[model samples]
Target chain A: MKLSIDRQIYSDACISKVVYWLSAQYAIERTLDGTIETLSISRNDGHPFDETELRSQCLRLLNDYKLRQTIDDETRDIRTILYAKAFADDENLTVE
Target chain B: MKYYLLPFKFTRIGDHEVFVNEVGDMLHAPIGTAEQIVNRTIEDPELYKSLVANFFISEIRIPALLDVYAERLAEKKRFLDDYTALHIFVLTLRCNQNCIYCQASSRDEHCAASSMSRENMRLAVQHMFKSRSQYLTMEFQGGEPSLEHDLFLYGIELAEEINQTEHRHLTYVLCTNSINLTDEVMATCKQYNVLISTSLDGPSWLHNQNRGKQDSYEKVVKGITKAREILGADRVSALMTASELSLNYPIEIVDEYHKLGFTSIFLRALNPYGKATDNADWEAYTNRFIEFYKQAFEHIIELNKQGHVMIEEYAAIILRKLLTPWCTGFVDLQSPAGIVNSVLIYNYDGYMYASDESRMLAEENDFTFQIGKLSESYENLVYSPKVKEWSKVWNNEAIAGCSDCALQAYCGADPVRNHSTQGDLYGFRPTSLFCKKNKAIIEYIISCVIDRYDELMPIFRNWIR
Candidate 1:
């Protein structure tokens, strides 16, 4: 199956995340054409999957990865702080 | 109404979105429920109440129970609270059988130099007592630990002598191929009340084929029976590793165990180590193992329905996380990755490794997980700079892909696996076979609970009990 995803909407990193999970099921090859990212997917052994369901699942996973990316982006500083508070020594330091 | 969202993730299981919170509290809400919660537009009063009760959403701007939630999360990770409770002493690399997928890379029985010396065994026993853990499990492993009957006996005797005054609760386990389990080994096991943990691949032909011996299955079965006769049926147990050929015979494997009168089966996957790395394709094997696990689990459930008490241990471990607040002592599924925290390996070379897999890696000439030397103090071994490094990426919550996973609460972090397979301590999740296998199995287990709750719950409860 060949599908072109809007690179503006889904970053290469996000697309890679989705592809990583699907790599076990599908042999995925990615290429960049200007602003459009093309994904060529084929089953490792069996016949090709249904294009509609495959695309839908891919987009769903892409959305999830993007959401997680957003969460990770937003919470990066807080997570560092939390870890520092939980594990690192900070007895002499004051929280501003 | 204003609301607060706790740390959680959701995935579409069947038609509904199942949400899981940080502490493993879960709720199956309808599609678009996540968006509604995000937008603060969940209008259904009952759904809202369920969300709040299940720790998905809190109505208070700043929840008063945040401290309590932190405490509960700490409780869920209580395995980290205990010191290394399981100390494995790999007595030797000498064995009788040449199993095809032998992870230990065992040498022949005549190779006396491959076995642990009495001095190392004594030092290892003293090291075992150094841990402040009230409960300690001293497990014996080997090429075949039973081959070095003298070392095994001496190790146990030293531990028993120390426990006379130190008096920490002690449990002894012998992990053997059972082929070398002679009358002497059985008598020693009976004396110390040592539990015999043997490997049984499947029925006769499959078992023998995997072990590279025609009568290996017979020897193992005979060993199991003999051990049970002396140690009591409940004390002796067996575990199976799904080799490439074993994948094609899940039901047969379950039947073999049932025929042997064993109540539980741990359908463990093959690690990519030692001679077992001969497995051609792990991705294909993992998928097949998932199917094999589901089929065998269903068969076990059917047997339970027929009034036979049987359990699939992997399911039981995941189910404990899903159905109860208590955590399992299983090392593989732990966040700190069960290395050093829950289990440590004292190899014949006098080096203490993080886990059994660590020692196996050492056999392949990789010492990535050798934490310390047995000659060192337990304090230095447990609190080494290397162990401090492992603590960094050992939590799933702290990992990149695993952090956002809905099953993170049920799953764990394995730095050793990641380091071995992916060439790093922090694993790449998207390409992780560990993540793929655990996710598929855990999701399948939850699907069973969700799709066939009434029919399976009684059986699941029976197994856990």
Candidate 2:
């Protein structure tokens, strides 16, 4: 339960995930304690994606890298596992 | 199928997820092990990812997530019940100068008869006031708004009269050359509380060359200084254009504004219409113009760093996109198109142009924006099938680059500009020089302000707010 990885790995994962949700133009700023303090982008262009899930996935991706460090896990396999179910349920949306 | 992962944190309570803002910031929430949710998600793999891809990026709008998701971006944008047009009333196309790249300049004096008559001007004003939108702006444009001082005065008084009599809320402005800012004109403007805009195409030589037959440089500097003296600094500002000769002296343009004490400069790209198309060849590759913009803007930002307090017009517009979640009310950036959304252009000849650019195109016999006429009822002009079709086409925000760009939400691409310049509602080459020029400015501002930025956040927020 005390699963962890180096701050460097976590940092890389965090960067990758933020870059995932945002282009290089955005990121989640962190406090000295390494806790996320803000989420921001580089431009005012409109965003239509879910901010909550985007953040959640970004964190999840970081944890996945951490999990790989602690367990006998495949990073590629975990990424696949995380995204596999996205297609079929992608359409279950409500229009305004 | 949910499997626990490590090292990541999520805003969660037990197993439930939390929403984030446009910037990824979340309100205070109890932290739960993202590991647990990942494990739980892993157990029922398809269910979790499906919900996610749907909620996060899919084209469909998921109902259960609607209120929550909409709230996340509500800070950046709002759901508007109605769209408005940006009315740019071209009071007179009879410009004093025969500049090579004057987009609205007359190709010949043939258009001298095209000045908006007093009757049409009154009708246009009446219709604009009677319109349903609470917010409005009436822009006086011309060979110089001051040149037609009486008609310009009549237009402003009419607008103010309607403002008090009909209880209409509107802002009055004029785009003019500094050459004609007589004391009488200034008094009329002050009485009306009008915002006046002018141009300074750089130092004397450059300014004189394009402005025609007169001492343009001295004229603009003096006029602007006088207008500022009388109108107060807040009401007067200027725009710059980069023509062929201008490409060689971009910094001089910036310097000219600084010497005159302007805090903002609009480095407007030339719209290739009207007199400009004939002179487009006067400038070389647009890439050169990009170099001009890039250098001028980057230097201006450096000046801002040194506390000179200058802004590149294009950059400020782009910075608003990079820094906020909403669109600046710039007419050029509107979708459903700002063309007919807020303002309709009534040409001097009594025809309605969808946008000012459309009027320029009219020089080539193209009348895409001639939606109606002052001779006709204004109500019928706005609600007509032509207006609807144009608005519909304008509103269908579906350019590939725009839809996919990270900054799409921050921008309102001007289809009218694109339609006039590139001849398409959605230009496939948005990544081309024109688009890159816009994008680079955003890139530069973001590069400059970001978290290392402490002072500009207020202005940045104001831009989008």
Q: Each candidate: what lDDT?
A: 0.84, 0.60
Residue B235 of model 2 has an lDDT of 97
Per-residue lDDT of candidate 1, residues A6-51 (tens digit)? 9999888899878877887799899999999999999988786788
| Model 2, position B441: C-alpha lDDT score | 54
DockQ per candidate, 2 decimals: 0.21, 0.03
The sequence of per-residue lDDT tens digits that candidate 2 reaches over residues B15-124 is: 33432223222221223323434444334445445434433222222234444544434333332322453456676766666776677755333446757789988888
Clashing pairs in 1: none
Per-residue CA lDDT of candidate 1, range B138-219, in tens?
9999888998899999999999999999989999999987777788999999999998898999999999999888888888
All predictions: root-mean-square deviation over Cα? 3.9, 13.7
Residue B225 alpha-carbon offset, candidate 1, angstroms: 1.4
Deviation of model 1 at A56, angstroms: 4.3
The TM-score, computed over Cα atoms with residue i paired to residue i, of candidate 1 is: 0.88
User: What value of lDDT does candidate 2 attain over all alpha carbons?
Assistant: 0.60
After superposition, candidate 2 runs with Cα above 4 Å error: A1-96, B1-85, B107-112, B279-284, B430-434, B447-465
